[model samples]
Target chain A: EDKVVQSPLSLVVHEGDTVTLNCSYEVTNFRSLLWYKQEKKAPTFLFMLTSSGIEKKSGRLSSILDKKELFSILNITATQTGDSAIYLCAVALGGSEKLVFGKGTKLTVNP
Target chain B: SAVISQKPSRDICQRGTSLTIQCQVDSQVTMMFWYRQQPGQSLTLIATANQGSEATYESGFVIDKFPISRPNLTFSTLTVSNMSPEDSSIYLCSVRQGALTDTQYFGPGTRLTVL
Candidate 1:
Protein backbone atom coordinates (compact mmCIF):
# COMPACT_ATOMS: atom_id res chain seq x y z
CA GLU A 1 0.00 0.00 0.00
CA ASP A 2 1.16 3.54 -0.77
CA LYS A 3 1.54 5.46 2.48
CA VAL A 4 2.19 9.07 3.46
CA VAL A 5 2.83 10.00 7.08
CA GLN A 6 2.89 13.48 8.58
CA SER A 7 4.34 14.41 11.96
CA PRO A 8 2.94 16.46 14.84
CA LEU A 9 -0.72 15.96 13.92
CA SER A 10 -1.47 19.39 15.37
CA LEU A 11 0.62 22.40 16.39
CA VAL A 12 -0.09 25.72 18.06
CA VAL A 13 2.27 28.63 17.76
CA HIS A 14 2.17 32.35 18.36
CA GLU A 15 2.51 34.82 15.54
CA GLY A 16 6.04 35.24 14.17
CA ASP A 17 7.08 31.72 15.15
CA THR A 18 8.73 29.48 12.60
CA VAL A 19 7.38 25.99 12.14
CA THR A 20 8.51 22.93 10.22
CA LEU A 21 6.08 20.23 9.10
CA ASN A 22 7.29 16.82 7.99
CA CYS A 23 6.01 14.22 5.51
CA SER A 24 7.44 10.82 4.74
CA TYR A 25 6.13 8.50 2.05
CA GLU A 26 6.51 4.98 0.75
CA VAL A 27 5.25 4.77 -2.80
CA THR A 28 5.89 2.70 -5.87
CA ASN A 29 7.39 4.46 -8.87
CA PHE A 30 7.40 7.83 -7.19
CA ARG A 31 6.77 10.77 -9.45
CA SER A 32 6.39 13.99 -7.46
CA LEU A 33 5.49 15.44 -4.10
CA LEU A 34 3.08 18.31 -3.51
CA TRP A 35 2.09 20.62 -0.67
CA TYR A 36 -1.26 22.30 -0.18
CA LYS A 37 -2.77 24.72 2.34
CA GLN A 38 -6.40 24.04 3.12
CA GLU A 39 -8.22 26.74 5.06
CA LYS A 40 -11.73 25.51 4.60
CA LYS A 41 -13.20 23.09 2.09
CA ALA A 42 -10.74 23.64 -0.75
CA PRO A 43 -7.03 23.02 -0.69
CA THR A 44 -4.88 25.58 -2.48
CA PHE A 45 -1.74 24.45 -4.27
CA LEU A 46 1.57 25.42 -2.68
CA PHE A 47 4.55 23.59 -4.12
CA MET A 48 5.54 20.63 -6.31
CA LEU A 49 8.93 19.02 -5.66
CA THR A 50 10.15 16.62 -8.34
CA SER A 51 13.85 16.48 -7.60
CA SER A 52 15.94 15.75 -4.56
CA GLY A 53 18.08 18.36 -2.75
CA ILE A 54 16.15 21.20 -4.45
CA GLU A 55 13.95 23.64 -2.59
CA LYS A 56 10.74 25.29 -3.72
CA LYS A 57 9.79 28.56 -2.11
CA SER A 58 6.91 30.99 -2.08
CA GLY A 59 7.42 34.08 0.07
CA ARG A 60 7.59 33.03 3.72
CA LEU A 61 6.95 29.37 2.90
CA SER A 62 9.53 26.94 1.51
CA SER A 63 9.76 23.17 0.98
CA ILE A 64 12.48 20.64 0.26
CA LEU A 65 12.41 17.01 -0.73
CA ASP A 66 14.91 14.23 -0.06
CA LYS A 67 14.10 11.36 -2.39
CA LYS A 68 16.82 9.08 -1.04
CA GLU A 69 15.16 9.10 2.36
CA LEU A 70 11.68 9.46 0.85
CA PHE A 71 10.63 12.47 2.89
CA SER A 72 9.81 16.15 2.53
CA ILE A 73 9.68 19.14 4.83
CA LEU A 74 7.68 22.36 4.74
CA ASN A 75 9.04 25.40 6.55
CA ILE A 76 7.12 28.51 7.41
CA THR A 77 8.98 31.65 8.51
CA ALA A 78 7.33 34.29 10.65
CA THR A 79 3.91 32.77 10.56
CA GLN A 80 0.86 34.92 11.09
CA THR A 81 -2.70 34.19 12.09
CA GLY A 82 -3.49 34.08 8.39
CA ASP A 83 -1.17 31.11 8.08
CA SER A 84 -3.40 29.00 10.27
CA ALA A 85 -4.64 26.09 8.19
CA ILE A 86 -4.19 22.41 7.52
CA TYR A 87 -1.05 21.63 5.56
CA LEU A 88 -1.40 18.56 3.38
CA CYS A 89 1.30 16.54 1.67
CA ALA A 90 0.62 14.22 -1.26
CA VAL A 91 2.63 11.99 -3.55
CA ALA A 92 1.93 11.15 -7.17
CA LEU A 93 2.86 7.80 -8.66
CA GLY A 94 4.72 7.49 -11.95
CA GLY A 95 2.12 5.47 -13.84
CA SER A 96 -0.94 7.00 -12.23
CA GLU A 97 -1.85 10.65 -11.69
CA LYS A 98 -3.83 9.89 -8.58
CA LEU A 99 -2.36 11.43 -5.43
CA VAL A 100 -1.85 9.59 -2.17
CA PHE A 101 -2.32 12.04 0.66
CA GLY A 102 -1.13 12.31 4.24
CA LYS A 103 -3.40 12.86 7.21
CA GLY A 104 -2.16 16.49 7.29
CA THR A 105 -0.75 18.87 9.92
CA LYS A 106 -3.17 21.24 11.53
CA LEU A 107 -1.42 24.49 12.38
CA THR A 108 -2.83 27.21 14.59
CA VAL A 109 -1.26 30.65 14.64
CA ASN A 110 -2.29 32.72 17.57
CA PRO A 111 -2.19 36.47 17.44
CA SER B 1 -4.98 26.21 -13.73
CA ALA B 2 -8.66 25.24 -13.96
CA VAL B 3 -11.53 26.71 -12.02
CA ILE B 4 -13.66 23.90 -10.64
CA SER B 5 -17.07 24.32 -9.05
CA GLN B 6 -19.29 21.90 -7.16
CA LYS B 7 -23.03 22.20 -6.80
CA PRO B 8 -24.91 22.49 -3.50
CA SER B 9 -22.10 23.68 -1.28
CA ARG B 10 -23.76 21.62 1.43
CA ASP B 11 -26.77 19.44 2.03
CA ILE B 12 -28.48 17.62 4.85
CA CYS B 13 -30.10 14.43 3.71
CA GLN B 14 -32.06 11.76 5.47
CA ARG B 15 -30.84 8.20 5.77
CA GLY B 16 -31.66 5.88 2.82
CA THR B 17 -31.60 8.87 0.45
CA SER B 18 -29.10 9.59 -2.30
CA LEU B 19 -27.41 12.75 -3.49
CA THR B 20 -25.58 13.43 -6.69
CA ILE B 21 -22.84 16.06 -6.64
CA GLN B 22 -21.86 17.81 -9.85
CA CYS B 23 -18.48 19.19 -10.78
CA GLN B 24 -17.86 21.67 -13.58
CA VAL B 25 -14.53 22.84 -14.91
CA ASP B 26 -13.94 26.16 -16.56
CA SER B 27 -11.82 24.62 -19.31
CA GLN B 28 -11.43 21.25 -20.94
CA VAL B 29 -9.75 18.57 -18.86
CA THR B 30 -8.78 14.96 -19.44
CA MET B 31 -8.99 13.64 -15.91
CA MET B 32 -11.45 14.43 -13.14
CA PHE B 33 -11.44 12.80 -9.72
CA TRP B 34 -13.78 12.46 -6.77
CA TYR B 35 -12.63 12.32 -3.16
CA ARG B 36 -14.19 11.95 0.25
CA GLN B 37 -12.91 13.55 3.47
CA GLN B 38 -14.66 12.38 6.55
CA PRO B 39 -14.74 14.69 9.52
CA GLY B 40 -11.26 14.78 11.04
CA GLN B 41 -9.83 12.55 8.31
CA SER B 42 -7.67 13.12 5.27
CA LEU B 43 -8.93 13.09 1.72
CA THR B 44 -9.38 9.69 0.07
CA LEU B 45 -9.70 9.24 -3.66
CA ILE B 46 -13.00 7.67 -4.54
CA ALA B 47 -12.51 7.22 -8.27
CA THR B 48 -10.93 8.59 -11.40
CA ALA B 49 -13.38 9.81 -14.03
CA ASN B 50 -12.14 10.08 -17.54
CA GLN B 51 -14.06 10.97 -20.66
CA GLY B 52 -15.25 8.11 -22.92
CA SER B 53 -14.74 5.42 -20.30
CA GLU B 54 -16.12 4.11 -17.06
CA ALA B 55 -14.69 5.54 -13.88
CA THR B 56 -11.91 3.59 -12.17
CA TYR B 57 -12.59 3.29 -8.48
CA GLU B 58 -9.94 3.04 -5.81
CA SER B 59 -9.68 0.18 -3.35
CA GLY B 60 -12.46 0.12 -0.72
CA PHE B 61 -14.68 2.08 -3.09
CA VAL B 62 -17.19 0.55 -5.50
CA ILE B 63 -19.22 1.84 -8.41
CA ASP B 64 -22.53 0.82 -6.87
CA LYS B 65 -21.98 2.86 -3.74
CA PHE B 66 -20.44 5.82 -5.55
CA PRO B 67 -21.37 5.89 -9.21
CA ILE B 68 -19.55 8.41 -11.37
CA SER B 69 -20.09 9.81 -14.84
CA ARG B 70 -17.67 11.70 -17.05
CA PRO B 71 -19.58 12.27 -20.27
CA ASN B 72 -17.23 15.04 -21.37
CA LEU B 73 -13.91 16.58 -20.50
CA THR B 74 -15.21 19.51 -18.55
CA PHE B 75 -17.84 17.92 -16.37
CA SER B 76 -18.46 14.99 -14.07
CA THR B 77 -20.74 13.85 -11.26
CA LEU B 78 -20.55 11.54 -8.24
CA THR B 79 -23.67 10.03 -6.74
CA VAL B 80 -23.66 8.75 -3.20
CA SER B 81 -26.30 6.09 -2.70
CA ASN B 82 -28.19 5.08 0.45
CA MET B 83 -26.82 7.67 2.78
CA SER B 84 -26.08 6.82 6.40
CA PRO B 85 -24.70 8.86 9.27
CA GLU B 86 -21.39 7.24 8.56
CA ASP B 87 -21.60 8.68 5.07
CA SER B 88 -21.47 12.26 6.30
CA SER B 89 -18.42 13.78 4.76
CA ILE B 90 -17.04 16.48 2.51
CA TYR B 91 -17.01 15.46 -1.14
CA LEU B 92 -14.30 17.17 -3.15
CA CYS B 93 -13.94 17.38 -6.93
CA SER B 94 -10.59 17.80 -8.59
CA VAL B 95 -9.17 18.06 -12.10
CA ARG B 96 -5.76 17.28 -13.52
CA GLN B 97 -4.47 19.41 -16.36
CA GLY B 98 -1.18 19.68 -18.25
CA ALA B 99 1.24 16.86 -17.29
CA LEU B 100 1.24 14.09 -14.73
CA THR B 101 3.33 16.24 -12.42
CA ASP B 102 0.93 19.12 -12.63
CA THR B 103 -1.08 20.10 -9.60
CA GLN B 104 -4.74 19.12 -9.41
CA TYR B 105 -7.06 22.05 -8.76
CA PHE B 106 -9.98 21.35 -6.47
CA GLY B 107 -13.52 22.58 -6.09
CA PRO B 108 -14.92 24.18 -2.95
CA GLY B 109 -16.43 20.78 -2.02
CA THR B 110 -19.84 19.64 -0.86
CA ARG B 111 -20.43 19.09 2.83
CA LEU B 112 -22.94 16.28 3.32
CA THR B 113 -24.62 15.50 6.60
CA VAL B 114 -26.65 12.30 6.72
CA LEU B 115 -29.20 11.95 9.50
Candidate 2:
Protein backbone atom coordinates (compact mmCIF):
# COMPACT_ATOMS: atom_id res chain seq x y z
CA GLU A 1 0.00 0.00 0.00
CA ASP A 2 1.16 3.53 -0.72
CA LYS A 3 1.31 5.66 2.39
CA VAL A 4 2.94 8.84 3.71
CA VAL A 5 3.90 9.17 7.35
CA GLN A 6 4.83 12.37 9.17
CA SER A 7 6.62 12.38 12.48
CA PRO A 8 5.80 14.49 15.55
CA LEU A 9 2.07 14.56 15.05
CA SER A 10 1.86 17.73 17.14
CA LEU A 11 4.42 20.23 18.31
CA VAL A 12 4.51 23.39 20.38
CA VAL A 13 7.35 25.87 20.26
CA HIS A 14 8.12 29.47 21.14
CA GLU A 15 8.38 32.22 18.64
CA GLY A 16 11.71 32.59 16.80
CA ASP A 17 12.41 28.92 17.25
CA THR A 18 13.20 26.83 14.22
CA VAL A 19 11.33 23.61 13.44
CA THR A 20 11.92 20.69 11.16
CA LEU A 21 9.00 18.50 10.06
CA ASN A 22 9.71 15.05 8.66
CA CYS A 23 7.80 13.03 6.07
CA SER A 24 8.53 9.49 4.88
CA TYR A 25 6.67 7.58 2.22
CA GLU A 26 6.49 4.10 0.73
CA VAL A 27 4.82 4.18 -2.65
CA THR A 28 5.14 2.53 -6.00
CA ASN A 29 6.71 4.63 -8.72
CA PHE A 30 6.96 7.84 -6.74
CA ARG A 31 6.91 10.97 -8.82
CA SER A 32 6.90 13.95 -6.47
CA LEU A 33 6.42 15.10 -2.92
CA LEU A 34 4.45 18.19 -1.88
CA TRP A 35 4.00 20.22 1.25
CA TYR A 36 0.98 22.31 2.29
CA LYS A 37 0.03 24.60 5.12
CA GLN A 38 -3.52 24.67 6.46
CA GLU A 39 -4.67 27.29 8.92
CA LYS A 40 -8.47 27.30 8.78
CA LYS A 41 -9.73 26.62 5.28
CA ALA A 42 -7.97 25.06 2.33
CA PRO A 43 -4.34 24.11 2.37
CA THR A 44 -2.03 26.43 0.49
CA PHE A 45 0.78 24.97 -1.55
CA LEU A 46 4.13 25.38 0.08
CA PHE A 47 6.71 23.41 -1.87
CA MET A 48 6.94 20.58 -4.38
CA LEU A 49 10.09 18.47 -4.60
CA THR A 50 10.59 16.19 -7.57
CA SER A 51 14.29 15.58 -7.94
CA SER A 52 16.51 14.38 -5.19
CA GLY A 53 19.15 16.63 -3.54
CA ILE A 54 17.49 19.76 -4.84
CA GLU A 55 16.12 22.12 -2.19
CA LYS A 56 13.07 24.31 -2.74
CA LYS A 57 12.77 27.39 -0.58
CA SER A 58 10.38 30.24 -0.06
CA GLY A 59 11.50 32.89 2.42
CA ARG A 60 11.81 31.27 5.83
CA LEU A 61 10.37 27.97 4.64
CA SER A 62 12.32 25.37 2.74
CA SER A 63 12.04 21.68 1.85
CA ILE A 64 14.06 18.88 0.33
CA LEU A 65 13.50 15.31 -0.75
CA ASP A 66 15.80 12.26 -0.54
CA LYS A 67 14.77 9.51 -2.96
CA LYS A 68 17.20 7.01 -1.56
CA GLU A 69 15.59 7.25 1.89
CA LEU A 70 12.11 7.80 0.43
CA PHE A 71 11.66 10.77 2.73
CA SER A 72 11.41 14.54 2.84
CA ILE A 73 11.79 17.29 5.38
CA LEU A 74 10.37 20.79 5.76
CA ASN A 75 12.39 23.40 7.63
CA ILE A 76 10.92 26.58 9.02
CA THR A 77 13.21 29.23 10.40
CA ALA A 78 12.18 32.13 12.61
CA THR A 79 8.82 30.65 13.39
CA GLN A 80 6.01 33.02 14.33
CA THR A 81 2.57 32.74 15.82
CA GLY A 82 1.11 33.33 12.39
CA ASP A 83 2.89 30.18 11.24
CA SER A 84 0.76 28.03 13.51
CA ALA A 85 -1.13 25.60 11.32
CA ILE A 86 -1.30 21.99 10.19
CA TYR A 87 1.57 21.05 7.88
CA LEU A 88 0.70 18.32 5.41
CA CYS A 89 3.00 16.19 3.29
CA ALA A 90 1.81 14.29 0.25
CA VAL A 91 3.31 12.00 -2.35
CA ALA A 92 2.14 11.78 -5.94
CA LEU A 93 2.55 8.48 -7.70
CA GLY A 94 3.65 8.13 -11.27
CA GLY A 95 0.85 7.95 -13.84
CA SER A 96 -1.73 8.93 -11.19
CA GLU A 97 -3.16 12.33 -10.33
CA LYS A 98 -4.25 11.38 -6.85
CA LEU A 99 -2.08 12.40 -3.88
CA VAL A 100 -1.50 10.29 -0.78
CA PHE A 101 -1.23 12.61 2.21
CA GLY A 102 0.21 12.22 5.65
CA LYS A 103 -1.79 12.80 8.82
CA GLY A 104 -0.15 16.24 9.14
CA THR A 105 1.73 17.94 11.95
CA LYS A 106 -0.26 20.44 13.99
CA LEU A 107 2.31 23.12 14.82
CA THR A 108 1.65 25.71 17.49
CA VAL A 109 4.04 28.61 17.70
CA ASN A 110 3.62 30.46 20.97
CA PRO A 111 4.53 34.10 21.30
CA SER B 1 -2.43 27.16 -10.11
CA ALA B 2 -6.26 27.35 -10.30
CA VAL B 3 -8.50 29.51 -8.21
CA ILE B 4 -11.28 27.27 -6.92
CA SER B 5 -14.36 28.32 -5.01
CA GLN B 6 -16.92 26.29 -3.08
CA LYS B 7 -20.45 27.41 -2.23
CA PRO B 8 -22.14 27.10 1.15
CA SER B 9 -18.87 27.56 3.03
CA ARG B 10 -20.55 26.10 6.08
CA ASP B 11 -23.85 24.36 6.72
CA ILE B 12 -25.76 22.60 9.48
CA CYS B 13 -28.10 19.88 8.34
CA GLN B 14 -30.25 17.29 10.04
CA ARG B 15 -29.70 13.57 9.87
CA GLY B 16 -31.15 11.68 6.89
CA THR B 17 -31.10 14.88 4.85
CA SER B 18 -28.78 15.45 1.94
CA LEU B 19 -26.64 18.42 0.92
CA THR B 20 -24.95 19.18 -2.34
CA ILE B 21 -21.72 21.16 -2.40
CA GLN B 22 -20.69 23.10 -5.45
CA CYS B 23 -17.15 23.69 -6.70
CA GLN B 24 -16.30 26.30 -9.26
CA VAL B 25 -12.95 27.02 -10.82
CA ASP B 26 -11.97 30.37 -12.20
CA SER B 27 -10.26 28.85 -15.21
CA GLN B 28 -10.91 25.68 -17.18
CA VAL B 29 -9.34 22.59 -15.70
CA THR B 30 -8.75 19.08 -16.96
CA MET B 31 -9.46 17.27 -13.69
CA MET B 32 -11.33 17.94 -10.47
CA PHE B 33 -11.44 15.91 -7.28
CA TRP B 34 -13.53 15.72 -4.12
CA TYR B 35 -12.12 15.03 -0.70
CA ARG B 36 -13.34 14.63 2.88
CA GLN B 37 -11.36 15.75 5.91
CA GLN B 38 -12.62 14.80 9.31
CA PRO B 39 -11.78 16.99 12.27
CA GLY B 40 -8.08 16.86 13.00
CA GLN B 41 -7.56 14.18 10.36
CA SER B 42 -5.90 13.93 7.00
CA LEU B 43 -7.74 14.57 3.77
CA THR B 44 -9.16 11.53 1.98
CA LEU B 45 -9.97 11.50 -1.70
CA ILE B 46 -13.60 10.57 -2.27
CA ALA B 47 -13.84 10.75 -6.05
CA THR B 48 -12.20 12.08 -9.17
CA ALA B 49 -14.50 14.09 -11.44
CA ASN B 50 -13.65 13.98 -15.08
CA GLN B 51 -15.06 16.31 -17.65
CA GLY B 52 -17.99 14.76 -19.53
CA SER B 53 -17.61 11.43 -17.77
CA GLU B 54 -18.65 9.58 -14.64
CA ALA B 55 -16.75 10.31 -11.45
CA THR B 56 -14.32 7.63 -10.27
CA TYR B 57 -14.72 6.95 -6.58
CA GLU B 58 -12.07 5.59 -4.24
CA SER B 59 -12.18 2.57 -2.00
CA GLY B 60 -14.86 2.67 0.73
CA PHE B 61 -16.67 5.45 -1.16
CA VAL B 62 -19.63 4.53 -3.31
CA ILE B 63 -21.38 6.51 -6.04
CA ASP B 64 -24.87 6.02 -4.63
CA LYS B 65 -24.04 7.51 -1.27
CA PHE B 66 -21.78 10.25 -2.62
CA PRO B 67 -22.99 11.12 -6.08
CA ILE B 68 -20.81 13.51 -8.10
CA SER B 69 -21.34 15.53 -11.26
CA ARG B 70 -18.96 17.23 -13.65
CA PRO B 71 -20.99 18.80 -16.37
CA ASN B 72 -18.12 20.86 -17.63
CA LEU B 73 -14.45 21.45 -17.06
CA THR B 74 -14.85 24.21 -14.52
CA PHE B 75 -17.82 23.07 -12.47
CA SER B 76 -18.61 20.04 -10.32
CA THR B 77 -20.87 19.09 -7.46
CA LEU B 78 -20.77 16.47 -4.73
CA THR B 79 -23.95 15.39 -2.98
CA VAL B 80 -23.76 13.81 0.41
CA SER B 81 -26.79 11.57 0.60
CA ASN B 82 -28.49 10.53 3.84
CA MET B 83 -26.23 12.48 6.07
CA SER B 84 -25.40 11.59 9.66
CA PRO B 85 -23.36 13.08 12.49
CA GLU B 86 -20.47 10.92 11.43
CA ASP B 87 -20.60 12.61 8.04
CA SER B 88 -19.76 15.97 9.56
CA SER B 89 -16.55 16.97 7.88
CA ILE B 90 -14.82 19.48 5.64
CA TYR B 91 -15.53 18.78 2.00
CA LEU B 92 -12.80 20.11 -0.27
CA CYS B 93 -12.50 20.50 -4.03
CA SER B 94 -9.19 20.20 -5.83
CA VAL B 95 -7.99 20.60 -9.40
CA ARG B 96 -4.95 19.62 -11.40
CA GLN B 97 -3.89 21.67 -14.40
CA GLY B 98 -1.91 19.89 -17.10
CA ALA B 99 0.36 17.13 -15.93
CA LEU B 100 -0.08 14.52 -13.22
CA THR B 101 2.37 16.28 -10.93
CA ASP B 102 2.01 17.38 -7.35
CA THR B 103 0.56 20.75 -8.24
CA GLN B 104 -3.04 20.27 -7.16
CA TYR B 105 -4.81 23.43 -5.97
CA PHE B 106 -7.73 23.31 -3.53
CA GLY B 107 -10.71 25.44 -2.64
CA PRO B 108 -11.56 26.94 0.71
CA GLY B 109 -13.72 23.89 1.46
CA THR B 110 -17.27 23.50 2.77
CA ARG B 111 -17.74 22.74 6.41
CA LEU B 112 -20.64 20.34 6.91
CA THR B 113 -22.09 19.86 10.34
CA VAL B 114 -24.68 17.12 10.52
CA LEU B 115 -26.83 17.12 13.58
lDDT of 1 by residue, A1-111 (tens): 899999989999999999999999999889999999998999999999999999999999999999999999999999999999999999988888689999999999999
Q: How do the residues B1-115 of candidate 2 rate in per-residue lDDT, one tens digit apiece?
A: 7789999899999999999999999999888999999988899999999888889999999999999999998999999999999999999999988764668899999999999
- lDDT values for all models: 0.94, 0.94
- TM-score per prediction, in order, is 0.98, 0.98
Calculate candidate 1's fnat.
Answer: 0.80
* Residue-wise C-alpha lDDT for candidate 2, range A1-111, written one tens digit per residue: 999999899999999999999999999989999999998979999999999999999999999999999999999999999999999999988887779999999999999
Which sections of candidate 1 miss by over 4 Å?
Answer: none
Candidate 2 runs further than 4 Å off: none
The alpha-carbon root-mean-square deviation between model 2 and the true structure, to one decimal in Å, is 0.9
Candidate 2 overall Cα lDDT vs. reference? 0.94
lDDT of 1 at B112: 98
